[model samples]
Target chain A: MSGPAVVFDKVSLELGGTRILDNVSFRIESGALHCIVGANGGGKTSLIRSLLGQMPHSGQIRLEGESLGPVGYVPQVLDFDRNVPMTVRDVMALLTQRKPAFLGSSREHRAGVDAALKRMGVLEKELRPFGGLSGGERQRVLFAQALEPAPSLLILDEPCANIDEPGARIVEDVVLELNAKGVTVVWINHDWDQVRKLAHSVTGINRKVMFHGVPSEVLTWAEPKAMVS
Target chain B: MNTIYESIRLTLQGLAANGTLPQAFTYQFVINALLCTLLIGPLLGALGTMIVVKRMAFFSQAVGNAALTGVAIGILLGESYTSPYISMFSFCILFGIALKYTQYRTNLSNDSLIGVFLSISLAFGASLLLYVSAKINTHVMESVLFGSILAVDYTDMNILLVVTLIASLVVLPLYNQMLLASLNPSLAHARGIRVRLLEYVFVVLVTIVTVACLKIIGAVLVEALLLIPAAAARNISRTLGGFVAGSVIIATLSCILGVLMPMQLGLPVPTGGAIVLVAALVFVVTTVMRTTLSRFRATGV
Candidate 1:
């Protein structure tokens, strides 16, 4: 319960006969804001998937320190036929409520859902169909879902992608607040400016861990040309 | 079975006593057919919502098509051509699982996979049907393909009843998990929901329903019953509850209307075709209503 929050030792992944990540190794400290930066198709999502146990990988991924209780994941934008009618409350109920959603949500969980939505500034849209919400609004709702029960490690994949300026600010604020409350955050980020401002530590990954250190030092060490190309 | 028939007869007689139904409706065959529809309609409506949400329309269609092959195999195995429940259920369930497993393992899109399975099943069924044509009466094949509600015997009714009960029990508790898996499988998996297992269960359930209702709805039009009601409901619903409820209502209405209209009008149309046509009409109306409402809202009228 006192060691690093996550330890990735010699992690290698080969997907569909292509090497996605090779010999990647890193350790994320407990209660620290860690940002992962990599170019497109550079195994950023693959690395997260490996950590989430969604993909097969070789080597060790140990979630140490305090039992690693209840990791929250805010996945990328949902890719589905949005025409399937489902409201935000329905989605939340699918995740949080134990009973069947078709039977209707229990009153006990409604207040909790409302509180979470309010925190994400989407309380009014709680009853709106998820397909009808704007992309930014959907992102906020997803964030709200992840925040429920307060995960020990919150893993977000491109939390700001396709979000408006105000939505981005709201995300930043919520992330900072979670980090301040001792929630370990592993963010996959694209904006270097935000990484510099928010990340306690930054790791440059391009199929492997190229650099890992404090944000300032890692920023100087990770050259864009070397990492991406 | 006799008691069931007697009770249905009495019910129809009582309705006739109150001048609710004509004397023609009290016949045993008519009563049996109506009871079968009552059992199958709401279940189809409920399951169809998930079928549409998960984009498994073609998959269900493939299952339906596979039922023909199942029947053909049953005939080849020397089972009664008229009631081939064993081979039909086994073959369709296996076929559905294989389709699902192949889709999971390969990169083929769902529709393409279903198309492949559909073609293969149809080819197999056609050849077997031709081979068995000399041994069995052709009218049996016609009934399997296009449905004959008059053939909904006591055994078929009991199977439908048991299937409806089992399907309700299994699907009701797992409904949310299945919906979650359909909406976002990775998230559901992260939450410890067995996404793959749930998917297989859903596929098998669709197979069961398709096979059970084949005698009344036919192999060719069963998927239509599974798809059109949900599609129409989706056109008007804003929430999952409303979508499911609307689908049930539309499906039940379509089933009743499809059956009674043909009987009342003395039309010689296949019951399955009649049901599908009714569902299609509902879909068209709902689509038009949705478009009109959206347009009116946009124009502030």
Candidate 2:
């Protein structure tokens, strides 16, 4: 049961005649919060997409010694179709996948959803329309939705992009907390200060993996200015 | 002049004394019309919410139009309209699967693909109708072109009910996944929500509703039944659940009022057209109310 949480070997991706990620290789150990920092269009998203099996790429990604299945995904921000009205509880209900043929969602399922929302600090707002939530609150709800399944690996892309400083700090705290509980985290962020503070390991990419190790080892003040600044 | 005035007074009295029970209650024809509305009411309302939420109103219309060829085939083969469900379901499901599989492959958007299939199917249906009219009762063409709720029988009623229940069951179980997928597909996909499958399911559900309820709504205006009420509901609600619940209420009211309109007023309107007109009216009223309320709040007068 103990192995690298994620292993990406010889991953190469080409999109529209440009190499998004060329011959990338890395292995993130279990319980490590690995921050992926790169300049815009620097293969960070592509690499994550490949990991999620969204993009067509040639690579072998393994999770816990097996082929990487669908990992839990949290996006930078949520843009929903406003026509469909939905409350936070309704969205949480979606996570239970309750079928009508069954009697109903078990108490355990409801408890799990309640617990997850509480953990994200949006329990009271569960009845609120998901559309009405602020950007940070929506991110937490999305995080709760992703975490409800207790995914073995969590993949987030630009989670703090549009939020204020306090919101970003909340997200950072949540990520660190999840990592502390032994959940593997792969995060993409433009914020180096937060990344350096929270990330146990870091990978800098510009269409390829530049470095992979402790955050201090990979992200230096000079040379990789595109990433740090 | 005195006699004419007396006649006008008599008419007004009779109209007022009709007991506020819309004219559709005046005769067996009216009763049948109401029954038609009752049968298709909740089904269309529910489907409307799903359609608006999923943004598949156009897709449903395309599938509804495509069912014309199936109906033509059923009637041509000497089978009743009841027999068309087989062909219609198969055709719609095939179209749905095609839409789902080709979604990511082509540069043309989903609606464009739907349009392509829709036009092709309509063309095929028109030719089929023409060919069949040459062999059988020409009136069959009228039924397919418009709709005939007067012809609805116990079997049709049963079909509509069954379809409604099944659709509700299917949708309720996967409501969350469907909602998430509809709202933020990329996020849903990343969260392991099986976005493609849910998309396929959404399409298939809309297709089923189209074929099942086409007898009441017809091909041309089916999308209206699926959009108008939901749109009207959206004017008042801020959340997805509210929208869906509000859509059902508005749709049900529209159905009842729509049926009542033609009967009570002797409007000579097709029932399908009446329903759509009522739904449109509801949307207008709600929109006006919303605007007025917002303006009042802004002005603080």
Candidate 3:
């Protein structure tokens, strides 16, 4: 039930003659809720992209696991056209199955898609056009898709970027619940309070590994006032 | 395949003799044209959904324009006018790949790239048409620019049939992945789908279908057949299944009526223009209906 420990060895990435990430190295303990904290344009997404093999970077990123398990990813932003005519259920089928979406989502065989939506509180919106959903609702749908099949390693980039507060809380709960179940959660979190309160460890990146430590040790520089209170 | 076409033609002839169908169906060319529409309709309709959703309308239209240059180049290269398969196939495929490759290599937007490609192809087709007009008859030029129902034969029916089958087999099963790839290449790549490879496969599919369709839809108006049906379907449908099914039905009907109406009314319209006009009519009707329904819903009427 446990997941793999990820290792980054001297990772460096340069895009269009500009260095994005330079010689960054760190290790994320398997089965821990590890949060990545960084400012805007700090290459957090790029690092995760490298881990998912989306970018060509000079690095030896290894997942140390007995059996390499499935990796689930929820992107930071999904630009869906307003009139493309796809339902949330249709999108789940699109993301999760190789079955043609034109065949429609089979309720009998796709209990999992419904279940994940229920977990994210978007089950009622399953039949609605994906584009019509509010910003927070769309984020919930993305989280639902990533959680199904109970991935061994989940990579979330700003999962709560534009969501409302209550919606953000629901997503945060899911991440914590998933981590407690022994899934490796590599989350790029913009909200510092959630990371400070819940993350087992934190890694700060500003084109490099600026800091990597437990939440207690990391918050001294991020917010000394929060640490005092 | 020819036996199948022959048998269908005979059956239609029997139906026409028995007064079950119009007398126009008695002609082998009418039967041939209808058969071509039968296959081309569903193929373009279904692929059009993907093309429309991917925002590849311009790219596909550019390919249709390229088909003109392909045809002219085929004629100048001494290829026959009836079925210039090789020159047309190679040129369109090459044009499609090069356009896709340049999109990846250059900083220019896809529309700008397609715009430039379309302009060059149109210019090439214009001059080539003039050059070949002296050698081939002006009548043949009309057929090439627009579609000619009379020129369709059993060979075209067979080629269209094969492409339709191949396209259906490839597209129907992997439709989800293809949709995802176009929507979000990074997500598709993360899900272990080869995005770049799928792009090429899609380009090739569009090329073959575009070339195969040149006989009936013609170069100028083929993109209309591809876009109109799918656009109409999207205007009303709210789910993927409905969208695809609606597009296929509208497209099939448009193709059938496009070919038959011109013949029955004794109009001298080209088959390509006829098809587009019919499809555009459907699009207009559906759009009005959708707007009215939405307004009614807004007022709780």
Candidate 4:
């Protein structure tokens, strides 16, 4: 199914009497690989949170177009303890299976989960305890979970931050493959090189939209460097 | 219920007559206590896994202590001193919900909020106990603090059975969703799992179990049963299933032995203390086992 277009109109977020986002407005076309770039603590993540309805924000945020299906999210980091006995496969089952994760991975979703893992090149680590995985592997697993049941709209928070170059390639390839199938991919990134190299369109945010256009049109580094710096 | 009890009593009597069973098995209170354990042991163990996973050990403990206020309020408000099920449950549920609601509204760390609530409830319950103490046997108050398996009766068992059924039905099918919610609320919400509702369900589940088992596990030490067994299971477990299973086994054995061992040895130990001590022993043993296993792996021996 084709993905939906996203529209954010005059969205403003305030937390603890401090304005985190100010009248952020942008549109992401359907099937577009949209990159949102910004500096640390620059309201990029807050804008995503507001989009996901996790934060109470003012103004209208709407998904436009047909077949608006389930949203797939991969947060920057999973806030789990080091001692939990959850394995990589267990995490997969936790996201996909109807059975309790304690019962182990279910039969119906196992093949699909394995395929997703194999695509990310970490299928060998399926049995490894989630706490034992490397940061890169954990990030890949986060990316893998967004595939099944194959989300039409995938929201990724720094998907390539912890991964090395080859792992980043795997992510970029998979994300582009999904985009080719009309999936709307909203990626929050810090790497300007990646944004210039890959994104269909880019939005630079620092409490508001710093800049927005296709990569060719907005590749000027001065504005983004100043906004992010 | 009486007929069921009579039949079990008769069967135990027959075993005693045949010299195959201890005479304690035929006693009414012993049978009631065992039945209570059979229901509560697994429930506490299962819920304990989620409590540990969610890092809500202190929250569960606070709810357990709220049972003291529940009982004190129940007694003063003209509920039966022997079985104050209604008041005890409602008050504890209110306490649990209010605490959870306030958690989201406040900037205080969860521990601080829980500590504040715990202190107030204990102070309130203790002060009220003075007024209610004159109307009931001091033994009832002692059991409320430290628990007494021997104090359970047919009515208590029936209440426990219904509660066990309700908690199990809600928990079993939704266990995965609830875990998903606790582990990552945003993911669960994205998955359309109703994270907030599942959280409320868990709080109520903990509250009812705490209130229901007050007479057997006591207000002061009840969370120990919920935490220790799950912690022990976590020590050696390599997977979620094994963790839950190990917890349930440790808890069931602990509860049964806690009640029976005191009687078998003619010791005057309180049921809650015995149960927690047994679970604590298991926790220590598992911790040692895990350390040894890791050390051996490190040495490649």
Considering every candidate listed, which one attains the maximal TM-score?
A: 4
Given candidate 2, what's the lDDT at residue A101? 12
lDDT, model 2, position A131: 68
lDDT of 2 by residue, B155-267 (tens): 55567777777887888778767776766666666666787778787788777877776765576666777788888877776555556667777777777777667766779
lDDT of 4 at B112: 89
| Model 4 vs. true fold: TM | 0.95
Candidate 3: which stretches are off by over 4 Å? A107-109, A222-229, B124-142, B295-301
All candidates: DockQ? 0.50, 0.34, 0.52, 0.53
What residue runs in model 1 are displaced by over 4 Å at the alpha carbon? A1-4, A222-225, B1-5, B17-20, B265-268, B295-301
Pitting candidate 1 against candidate 2, the one with the higher lDDT is 1
Docking verdict class for candidate 4:
medium
Residues B1-301 of candidate 1 have per-residue lDDT tens digits of 6696777789897897788997667677777777887877799899999988787788766777788888888988988887899998999999989988998889687789999999999899888889888888867767666777766888888888888988999898888888888777767766667888998998899899888988877866677778889989888887778888989988888888887888788888766778888999999998888888874122111
Model 2 clashing residue pairs (backbone): A85-B239, A85-B240, A85-B241, A86-B239, A86-B240, A94-B176, B23-B264
Each prediction's total of clashing residue pairs, residues at least 3 apart in sequence or on different chains, is 1, 7, 0, 0
TM-score of each: 0.93, 0.83, 0.93, 0.95
Instruction: For candidate 4, write residues A43-107 as lDDT tens digits.
Output: 98888877777778999999998778878888887777857877788889889878888888888
What TM-score does the A-chain of candidate 3 achieve?
0.94
lDDT of 2 by residue, A79-176 (tens): 75633456677666664556421123446567777877888788999867676677788888877776676666778888777666766666677777
**Per-residue error at A1 for model 3, in Å?**
2.0
**lDDT at B232 for candidate 3?**
93
